[model samples]
Target chain A: MIAIHGFSPSGNCHKLRMLLEPLGQPYDWVEVDSPNGATRTPEFLALNPNGKVPVLQLQDGRTLTESNAILYYLAQGTPFLAEDRWARAQTLSWMNFEQYSHEPYVAVARFIAGWTPLDSPRRAELPRLRERSHQALAVMERHLQSNDWFSAGAYGIADIALFAYTDVAEHGGVALAPYPALRAWLARVRATPGFVPLPEPDALAADRIAQTA
Target chain B: MIAIHGFSPSGNCHKLRMLLEPLGQPYDWVEVDSPNGATRTPEFLALNPNGKVPVLQLQDGRTLTESNAILYYLAQGTPFLAEDRWARAQTLSWMNFEQYSHEPYVAVARFIAGWTPLDSPRRAELPRLRERSHQALAVMERHLQSNDWFSAGAYGIADIALFAYTDVAEHGGVALAPYPALRAWLARVRATPGFVPLPEPDALAADRIAQTA
Candidate 1:
């Protein structure tokens, strides 16, 4: 069995769970409290020198970091990944967009709103973050207008990658009302077989998220 | 020949040139002046709705966005990408790190210094960007200390991805002097067969980079 070192509320970490459950691939979940400086410790640094989470560790102790890469690794030889070269490249393109263009704005905004104190100075960034989040959302909306899935030709890892954060975007005050196509696509994703939603934020994060919104 | 819509001086765009040259693949370069708002034009948006450069257009009119994904596509079935699954995944992991952790700070700092006016308020971000840039460099240095290349078991697209911004980091006032291993790795990458350095910034931007540095 593979072990995943993750934070429950992080959409990046949740991405792995979303894929693993659907594939019925049993794995161990070793929770890491990323918000409270646990990832900064020496022990965690040994696992990943970059100090982020959702690391996939195999039985022999080899580990893989970066959620999207792990998704690609696990999805290979399964229908979760495509054999067509172009389709695979397109799948990767959307995953790259998720990490670079989408996650930095969408997921970071959620992190600030739900993980920080209400009066934290970082709150100053919300307006700009939300604005950027909408730009990313609009790009997804445009794509969704023509295409039903980001992972080329089907709902696969790319859909799982984008769905993790986009579903919880409202927690960051990024509204779904503006993108009808994106919302419709999200509903379609949820209706897929073996689908599982990300867990709701714990009480403290929920309170902060509510206050921030 | 395929067409590449790119900006010459951009590391993201340069990654493609680096790989294509090594593979002896012929290509058409359609220069997009991204800094001067060329990417914002309606004509360019039809090519890539996300409005970014370094888009790869197949002969049939299918287009691919995201620099790393394009690299993966162009490198397929070639020695530039690994054949083994684990090696390919690790190669992708490093490429993901370059985009998510490295490029936003290192490349953006270079953009701000070389492209923005010396008196532009964006200069205020330089210190923070450079600080984050060094943190990213440190991670690369640590990796290079243990291994010779970022791409698993070879000098491949992952190296091409990281090399683009890192080679010009000093333009952004992110000093390379602190990390000898990283500097050595840059030298090693340049020594690879058919390596092509990114074009120098044009005169106006060059002057700004000098002044900012």
Candidate 2:
């Protein structure tokens, strides 16, 4: 069994769970709540010096960090990842887009709104984050207008990577009401085999997000 | 021949040039000055909505965006990319690390220093950027203490991805004097076959960086 160290509420961490559930891979979950200083602990740092989750530990005790990298590792040779060379590269392009273009704005906004205290200074960054978040969403909407999926003509890890944070963008004050095609694409991803939605934010996070909204 | 649209000074754009040079692939280079608003033009945006440089155009006219993705596409089946599944995943992990943890700090600091005026308000971000940039270098230093190369026991695309920004990090106000292992790794990368250093910053950029320094 694979051992995954992750925080349940984190989109980056949840990406592993969502992908593995569909792959039917049995794995153990070791919760490491980063926002509360769990990730800063020496034990977690020993697992990943970068101090991020989820870290994937193979049965042989070797570990891999970075959520999208973990997805790529686990999805290899499976239908979850593309087999064609160009298609695979395209998949990787979208994954990089998720990490660089999309997540930094969308996911960071969510972290600030939900995880931080109500009066946290990070909230000052919301306006810029929201604008960039919408820009990323616009790109996704444009792509979805012509293609039904982001993951190389199929629902795969690319979709999983984007969907993890995008589906909960509302918590970040990013509404999806304007993106009709993106909304439809989200539905298609939800209908994929063995699909499991990310757990709802905890009560504290939900309350903070509500107050911020 | 592949057609590459890139900014001459940007490390992300230069990653492709470094890799393709070593691989001995014939390619055309179209100068896209992203800092001068070239990427925002309709023609360039049509090619890549992300408005970033290092966009690779295939012979069939399909364009691939994101520098690391382009590297993976070009390096596939070459010795630069590993044949073993685990090693390849590890390579992808380091590439992802370069984009996520390293580039955002190191590369962005370089842009703020060189592209913006010396008195630009963005310069205020330098201290924070420097701190995070050092954190990223520390991670690389730790990894280098045990491994000679980043990708599957060989000098490959992962090293290229990191070296692009790290070699020029001093321009971003990040000194390598403290990181002996990382400095040694940089030297090793410089010695690799067919290696070409990143181009020096343009006159305007160099002047601004000098003023900031």
Candidate 3:
């Protein structure tokens, strides 16, 4: 049995749940909210000194942190992980892109608008964040215009990483309507067998989008 | 032939270079200085929508950006990438850690100290950068204390991703002396077969605690 400690609203956390659902793996859940600083507590800190959520306590009790890491763990050897060398490389390419390009912009923007108070000090960052974030989304939209998946022709960890934030990017004031291809890709991923919706409280909106064309 | 666009001083960029040296692969180097905004050039941005350094251009004209992605691409199907399932997950775990926890701190600190002047506007971010950067280093110190290598108990791309920034961490005004285990791990990586010294602007001063240890 594995244990996941993270808040449901978080894209990083949602990514783990997404992969776990597809893998049909059962794991205990412990919520660690970032705003409440649950991850900073001594016990959780011991597991991941970095103090971030989506830490997966493995079957052996050796804990692993980082959302993408957890996804890769569950997805490997399943139909989700690519078999070809270059295809596998492409899988990681999108994963890296999510971290470097997509997540910083799109996810941060969402957090600012959706989680933080309207008058919070973090609001000042919204303008630049929105600009940088949309720039990244446009990139994804362009890619999805031609390719159904981020890499190769299958759903994998790469899609899970990008989809978590991207599907609900509007919460950050990002208008996904402009990106038709990205919207189409989201539906395609949702249609994957054993696909799971994010466990977030207001996840209905995203789930509907995912299931719809 | 692959074309890699990156600045020599960048640790992430060097991650790709270090691995390439070991593989004996020849690649065309298109120098891109993010500090100078060279990556923002239209031609470069066309290849990489993110406009970041370390974009790998494949022979088929498809471009791959992000350092770890390139490393995975160039290293796939080899001993550099773990062949076993669990080992592969471990490798991804560390690599993802490099992105979320490690890079944002250590890599950012490096950019601030090395790329800009002490009094530059970007230096304003230093205080927070410093604390978070050390927090990340501390986690590494604890991990390196027991594990000889990350994932598969052998040297892999994770080490290369981590080593690039860690080896020259002092450049970012980050001190590595307190972390004995991490320091020793650096030494082991340095002594590994096919290790390539990072290209320095001049010569690397050998007097640092990181080198001396």
The candidate that achieves the highest DockQ relative to the unseen native structure: 1
Best by lDDT: 1
Deviation in Å, model 3, residue A85 alpha carbon? 1.3
Worst 10 residues of 2 chain B by lDDT: B204-213
CAPRI-wise, candidate 1 is high
What class would a CAPRI assessor give candidate 3's docking?
Answer: medium
All-Cα superposition RMSD per candidate: 0.8, 0.8, 5.0
- DockQ of predicted candidate 1: 0.91
lDDT of 1 by residue, B61-112 (tens): 9999999999999999998899999999999999999999999999999999
Residue-level lDDT tens digits of model 2 in A46-71: 98999898899999989999999999
**lDDT value, residue B1 of candidate 3:** 89
Tens-place lDDT per residue, model 1, A23-94, is: 999999999998888899999999999999989999999989999999999999988899999999999999
lDDT of each model, Cα atoms only?
0.94, 0.92, 0.79
Model 1 Cα shift for residue A99 (angstroms): 0.8
Q: Candidate 1 — which residues are off by over 4 angstroms?
A: none
